[model samples]
Target: MSEPFDPARWRPAAFLPERDVRDPALIFAIAVLCFLACLTALGVIAGDRAAHGWSGQLKGEATVIVRARGGETPDAAAARAAETLAGVPGVSEARALEKEKAYDLIRPWLGDVTDLEDLPVPRLVAVSLDRKRPATATVLQEALKAQGVDAVVDDHQIWIKDIRRAAGVVRLSGASIFLLIALAAAAVVAFATRAGLAARRDVVQVLHLAGAEDNQIANLFELRFARVAAISGALGAIAAALTGALLRLIGGGAGITPALPIAWLDLLAVLPCPLLAAIVAVVAARLTARRLIQDL
Candidate 1:
């Protein structure tokens, strides 16, 4: 007597008892892949934030270095340059740094020497420009020259350009890493699906002979892989979140900006990694089963 089909009594994974042993390795691989993908996504977010921060801080700002010569002190030269810059059309404000502060800036490279004051350190003038009517380095230099102040203008554009280029490289590298991890995850799921199919070949052949559809057989593999992937991916995502949090805490303690900025919008990008991993596993399993089951 043929029993009626009852969805509640059907469990596809029951076809092979050995799946219990093999599934752990597959799950672990998926978890590692998910961890790497999440980390790369976080890296992309951090690079974007850092690039924006650098651009915001450096745009429309410049530095003036006043050289001391002909019996003029660095402070006097800096003061004259600041006074000249104050009247410039595009310049908003200028301030001369004190000698002690200047010495502190170079203390990192040159150790504390008692004759530090004797060193001819050029005075530094920080200049702010109105973005609406930005001042050019050439114009600032001409203004300083007209006032007989020997100074060099650094508009910081070069540094900003270098920072932007570096950010681009980081973003590209992160994307490449993400792609490789995703490919590796798909390969792992495919291999596991094929192994499971082989282990249950006899059952699959009987089901095929008994008039089961190809998709029906494929579903058996997909469901198993998808469930495993979801659990493993979630574990990996949690680990990544904890790691990011720890790094942020360390960065805060060290008085440095964290690579991963904690923002709701940025975190939203990371939240989908586990779900995407599950989807990848499901699709890989389905495709692998469909192709391999045809010979059965």
Candidate 2:
């Protein structure tokens, strides 16, 4: 049976050992960082979507506060203004809100009104802007003035600006955190590579004596650590995907809370984590190995 052994099937052994005792701990640490990074990416996606949604809704609308002039009732004046605005170009729909809605709007500041009927509360006209050609605040004002309606228009420019600013802040914070996590993971891998090189110094010296180049030696460590990081990244990515799936199911498509909505498609972002982790590890390990070897 042994006589049939083929020379063609022979394979050379790796310069580095197949596995190290410290592998489990290193994998665990790197995996944790990958998991956090994946989660951060998902948060950023959800937050950005939420911000765009709120801004889009506000962009397509305008509010008009109408004050009754002369002896006309507030409702009659508001109705007249609505009619006037409805006929204006770029105005999709214009209608006067009920008196109760106006009272509700004021209740936050004035609390419950005892003389609600006596108070001349300004009526609200909600104007839907045309998607293709929206009306400007100046245009709306001019139209209202020409019709002799005393009104003030709020185009939600202030609210939209604030939302966009907050969204930018969120995106910046998430990116910073994700960057820090990646660096920490790289640092851990670099440290492990240095430790490995130190422990294997005798083997490195023997290989050097046998005519191995510094880059050749460094490549061994790079391949070893890259494999470890890839495995860790896969584990972390799978865990993150499962957690995201659970959240999406619980919250439905819109997310659990209105603030953070997780969509199923967002989970796809983790798909590249393994390759990214491997690349980071390869760079970190190569640099650390070469530096240590040179110092030796």
After superposition on all CA atoms, what RMSD does each candidate show versus the true structure?
4.9, 3.0
Across 1-296, the per-residue lDDT of candidate 2 in tens digits comes to 55776779978888888988988988898888888888878888887777777777888899999999999999999999899999889999999999999999999999887668788899999999997798988899999999999999999999989988987887788788878876776677667666766777877777877988988987887888889989999888888888888888898867866778888899999999989888878887777767766776
Model 1 clash number: 0
Model 2 TM-score on a 0 to 1 scale: 0.89
Error of 1 at 61 (Å): 3.9
Clashing pairs in 1: none
Best by lDDT: 2
- Summing lDDT over every window of 10 consecutive residues in candidate 2, give the lowest-scoring window: 185-194
Runs of candidate 2 with Cα error greater than 4 angstroms are 1-11, 109-111
- The C-alpha TM-scores of every prediction are 0.75, 0.89
**Distance (Å) between predicted and true CA of 9, model 1?**
10
What's the true lDDT of residue 120 in model 2?
Answer: 86
Instruction: State each candidate's clash count.
Output: 0, 0
